[model samples]
Target chain A: MTSLLYKDWSIIKKTRALYFSVLYFSLIMPSFQNMDFFGKSFLANSYYIFIIYLLFSYLTAYDYKYNSDNFIPAFPVTKKQIVAARYVFVALTFAACLVLQSVVRIVILVLKGQDINIMNIMDYGQAAILILVFSLYFGIVLPLYYKLGYQKLRLLMIGAAVISGTVSSVLSEVGLDMNRPLVMLFAVIISAVIYYFSFTISVNIYKNGN
Target chain B: MNKVLEVIGLEKHYDNFTLDKVSFSIEPGYIMGYIGPNGAGKTTTINAILDIIKPDKGKIMLFGKELNGNACEIKQRIGFIIGENAFYEFMNAKEMAGIISRFYKRWDWGLFNKYMREFELDPGKKIESYSRGMKVKFALACALSHHAELFILDEPTSGLDPVFRSELMEIFQQIISDGEKTILFSTHITSDLDNIADYITFIYQGRIVFSRDKDSIMTEFALVKGRKDQRDMVLGSGKIKGMLESDVGFSALTDDRNWFFRNAPGSLVIERATLEDIMVHFVRGNKKYDKLAI
Candidate 1:
């Protein structure tokens, strides 16, 4: 499993996109003084974007680059081990982003002479939860890629994200409670459902004949 | 002898292509050559055998057991080298080895190092920096390191130079020399099979054309050259599978080389067919067969 994680890390590190995306979000966006938090919270929340788009792109690209299906299927390790390693890879990247985000947050606060309080940590924690929640999107959507192939699934996911976002906007316009506690609770429920479904789908995907 | 790998009636269907009931077996002590042209279902057959894709029909037996239920156990003894180099370009050979070693129960550090040394592969160099030959070498080293009972190689010689190709063949020969190991090597290069394969299986259009002993295949077909009229007469005899007609004359493949030599010594020139010749004949024949049906 350690080997698998190392393999995943090594693969993702090679891609310039991963580094640039993570660095831009985790370290760059958070430091911008004039950044409108309400207007660009999604962008400012680099941790969330890193987990969703970057990490998803990384894992998806990893399969194509390394022929993960060809190599991993041949190994003695079980499908469970392979799926576990994938999660670990995503988790490790999230952890790295957290550290980078914290350092950037501290540096930005020091430069501005602002009090870096527990509230800041809490904000970071919220971002971390959001990242985890978004990873649920990856877990649920990625397994479909095995069946549909990457190009098709990619377009499908893009369409799904757009449609879902549009629906969410319409719901919010109708006064759906998207306040902090409600959003957090919804995210938790969605994450749990996604996790359970992802695990099941991953197994089915592994067993699927290409 | 225990069968190390057995593929029976494995079938996969797509709108554009279908792998038609392909079957073959590798025993514990011999090498099987899986030979075909591009788009001939070599990789698909292998994918099915490995259960990377589920076959619509049939079964794959590995290590004397069914592959699905016994996948982990079977995989433990199987080392596969895919046709393509799919390693992380940034990771050096050492890191790649380090990562792969964790998954195998019988991973051998000393053997891995020995293979690296033998192949002159510098494990410290990143895969992106390595030449194609070096990448193949590194992949080979990884395939051989663990205590594998079976080695499945997909187009292992595609980019290799002649010298390295020979060296790789020697390693494969050495691997199976112990008599406990088996190999199923897929390649478009027939000469490699001529030198290494104990048995040969030819595939065309996602179907097995033939699977037989290398010796038998070699002995079966004779490349016969002759006048167009003479070849026509021979063709009329109904044993010819490969026939090429030209302005000057005709050359064809005959099942009985000795008979052609004996019966048409002055009419046709009989030549021994090498594996390459056999491959050319089959590939051409299959194409001609398709065209005629259309």
Candidate 2:
């Protein structure tokens, strides 16, 4: 599993220039003070989710470009292990993006001579929403990719991106309050169930697929 | 004899092709040449053995253990070079090797470096820049770095220069020289297997034509050339497995060389069939006898 993670990292390392540009854009977007609060929140949250999507896309593209799907199975790893590594990679990317965003937020607040609240409710709610959105999108995308290869699922991926974007925009537009701890807990539980089933389906699809 | 790999009654079906009841085995300390024409299920059989593709009905055993549920464990003892390029093209050979090394328990860095130097591959050069031959060499280097007991190579000699192809064959010979390693080499270039392969397994239209000792196969089949009139005699004798008739003369394949020698006219010329001759005749000729009568 660690090797699979390392393989993903190696692929990312090859596109260092492009990744750096994306990271620079992500870091500087939070510092733009001219935007309204809603706009600012939307930009930051979208970037957070987009980072995970971009990383997954890059890894999957690399796999397709190099025909890794044909060779990876020859390795001494089970289909379950491969699927588990992908899920773990998603989790790690989310964690890393959260840490980076939090650090950037702190540095921006400190430079502006503002107080930082370590236990901010809004911050927690936004993070939970981001996780839920990613979970929902990947829950649908990953298993489809395992069943039908990337080439066959290209149009479906675009459709999924559009649907997920509209869903996120609608949730923001309605301002549905997720401030309650119970609601956030329920969202997490639902997302967890979706992810677990997605992982199971992906394993079976990959095991039976060529 | 200690069998390192055994595939029994393997069957897979697609809309246009089906690997029907394919079966073969390879003993330790020998090379088995898997020769077949295009779309003959060579890659399918290898994929089934490697578990890259699932077979509907078959049993594959490696090292005396079933490979169905124990693929991960059994794969550790096997090395594979399946496609034209098996590593990430964006990464260099060294980085790819480093990543692959972590997957196997018996990966040898020293051996990998040795192959890297021997193959003249620069560790810093990206794989996309490498030529087709270089890519194959890099894959071969990685496949050999681990202390794997079995090697399954698909078209490893294709696209390589004759010098390197023979050199790679020599390396294969050296790999099994210790009487521990085994190889199942699949290639359309049958000449590469002429000097190295111990057993020959031929597949055509998703069926195994013959699987026997290479020497016996070579001796058992003969390419007979004579006038077109002899075609009826050859076909009537039931010794002609495959035949082609042209304007001037006709050529046919037969397993019973003694029958042809005794029955063929003095004007006919009989010669031993090379692997290519056998494959071409079997694949291109009529399927009157789908199975090898021998």
Best by TM-score: 2
List clashing residue pairs in candidate 2.
none
> Tens digits of per-residue lDDT for model 2 on B130-220?
9888888788888888899999999998888899898889889999999999999899999998877999999988999889999988888
| Predicted structure 1: lDDT | 0.72
Q: Each model's C-alpha lDDT? A: 0.72, 0.82
CA shift of A118, model 1, Å: 9.1
Question: Which is the leading candidate under DockQ?
Answer: 2
lDDT of each residue in B53-158, candidate 1, tens digit only: 6788889998778987888788878788885674665678887788788878889999999999988878888887888878888887888888888888888889
Candidate 2: stretches off by over 4 Å:
A21-25, A31-34, A37-40, A155-159, A172-186, B287-294
TM-score of chain B of each: 0.94, 0.96
Worst 10 residues of 2 chain A by lDDT: A32-41
